[model samples]
Target: MRYNYPHANLEFAVEALNISDESTLSSEDFATMMPRIQSLALRTKQWVTVIGGSRQVIQQLVNAGVSRSRIRWVAGRDADQREWATEQALLAGTSSVVLSFLDALSSPRVAQRLKMASKVSQTHSFVFRSLPSQSPLH
Candidate 1:
């Protein structure tokens, strides 16, 4: 794995992979996506968001000796919590917003909130989503 430890913190769009804890996805997906992340990271001054709730990945980054000062991992169950996370990320100058469990909620309210976050963040923010197949969200 090409681990870039001690990444500088900034804001960028988040892209989600399989997203949910429901799937045992591979690291290859992340490898494939990282080039894009790296490209965006190079073009702009922002942090790339790895959209998932996997403590393993987070821990891996930490274990790889990535600076905690540069990365913020958002984990919670409420949409409002996510909203709060968005705000925190912006304040922290995060560059990406990755949304997992996209099919967990179909309410336009959530989508609107995320959209608003992106809008509010301007080009500094990007959103990545992973939707389930034929799923009904809460």
Candidate 2:
């Protein structure tokens, strides 16, 4: 299924983007997400923070048409650090969108914290997870 950004009432929302493979982050899926990212970036003119994204993934986002200047790639080596950074980015309200590629978000507690933070800061957040044979923003 194609994932499109919800155009209305986007604030205070935290969603998930499930990927089947992490080793070979599929370009097709990443391409599908670009439009939403681009739309959010263009609409808000704010930074989009990417937590736990590798350099290759960052490059893919740039290749998919998101401006390099508008992206803030945060590569936290520690899982706790990455989760903390993701929450902070959402709570800070400096970024219009926060995209977290952390496995730790699979935890309900972590996801809940992020949801609250996004709501409090009114930031649109997307967390990427590795789930088998599924690729959709839920």
Candidate 3:
């Protein structure tokens, strides 16, 4: 199962997804998400915040057709804390979408904050959580 949030004028989707590795998204899974990000970025010609992906993943996204110039990688030590990154993105005021490989919707407060932040910033937040193989978080 995938978590979802509502954002008028912005699209948010989550589907039953699985990756071969429990820790990272497979190439195919990652590939499946690029076009949507690319589409959003290309429309505004603004940066797209990509949170938590490593250098290899970022490079793969570039090679797979996501614009290199439009990508703003945010794989810092605190990247897992989606709220902070989303706050930073909102503060920047130049990005149209913030794609985070995190469980932003896992916490009620974070989810609510993200909703308000996206609305105020006029941007979209797409949080991606690796489907847990064992127990659920919520």
Q: What is the TM-score of each candidate against the true structure?
A: 0.45, 0.68, 0.62
Candidate 3 similarity to native, TM-score: 0.62
Overall local distance difference test of candidate 1: 0.44
Candidate 3 lDDT, tens digit per residue, 1-138?
322334424333232121112433443465586776666656666787877655766676577566888789876565346557866785576886776666434455655666566655667656666323344667
Q: Which pairs clash (backbone N, Cα, C closer than 3 Å) in model 2? A: none
Best by TM-score: 2
TM-score, prediction 1: 0.45
For residue 32, what is the lDDT in candidate 2? 67
What's every prediction's RMSD, in angstroms? 10.3, 9.1, 9.0
| Number of the predicted model whose lDDT against the real structure is largest | 2
The whole-model lDDT of each prediction reads 0.44, 0.67, 0.59
**lDDT tens digits by residue: candidate 1, 26-138:** 34444454445445544543454544345554554445444444455666566456555654555454564332322243455644555554544542333333223344767
Which of candidates 2 and 3 reaches a greater lDDT?
Answer: 2
* Model 1 clash number: 12
What's the CA error at residue 9 for candidate 3, in Å? 5.1
